[model samples]
Target: MHRQYVVNLSRIREVERRFKGELFLVMDDQEQTMVPVSRRNAPAVRRALQI
Candidate 1:
């Protein structure tokens, strides 16, 4: 089954310092996952995370 999670932007920024390549780590309420933010969404992600 596929599960969807909602990771807060604050959490994303908390780990932004550890960004690797085009992927970054995010810890949701349950687990951690790497997010591959696409070019299209990169701007928004950066703006949101203030990276």
Candidate 2:
């Protein structure tokens, strides 16, 4: 499987732009899983997901 950031950019971006503070992803595929990221990576992670 791909790295967490490599896979979900859009969701990351939405979290960056629209939401504030810590981010959490609740994927339908991975229930009860947690994907935590650095604050610095948050923006790029989001942009990549948009692709």
Candidate 3:
């Protein structure tokens, strides 16, 4: 699909939930996912994961 957002998807938390707490995204096609948000660094999560 190769889709991307340029208008700033500020509601990235919703994306985190959609994947059932998957913090990391697959860098390779044959890899597991991640729940990019953490309770300890939730604020950073927003910036690091580009929320």
User: Highest lDDT, which number?
Assistant: 1
Query: Model 1: per-residue lDDT, tens digit, 1-51?
Result: 012434566655234333444545465645666655554666666677666
Overall lDDT per candidate, in order of appearance: 0.53, 0.45, 0.39
Q: Which candidate order results from sorting by TM-score in descending order?
A: 1, 2, 3
> What's model 3's overall lDDT?
0.39
Superposed model 3: Cα runs more than 4 Å off: 1-15, 18-29
Extract clashing residue pairs from model 2.
9-49, 10-49, 13-46
Model 3: clashing residue pairs?
Answer: 21-35, 22-34, 22-35, 23-34, 23-35, 23-36, 24-34, 24-35
**All candidates' TM-scores?**
0.48, 0.43, 0.32
Candidate ranking (lDDT, best to worst): 1, 2, 3
- lDDT string, candidate 3, 1-51, tens digits: 012312233333233343544343323223333334444555555566566
lDDT for 20 (candidate 3): 43
The local lDDT score (0 to 100) that residue 22 gets in candidate 2 is 54
Our tally of clashes for model 3 stands at 8
User: Better model by TM-score, 1 or 2?
Assistant: 1
Which residue runs of candidate 1 sit more than 4 Å off their true CA positions? 1-6, 13-21, 28-31
* Model 2: residues with Cα > 4 Å off, grouped in runs: 1-20, 28-30
Between candidates 2 and 3, the one scoring higher on TM-score is: 2
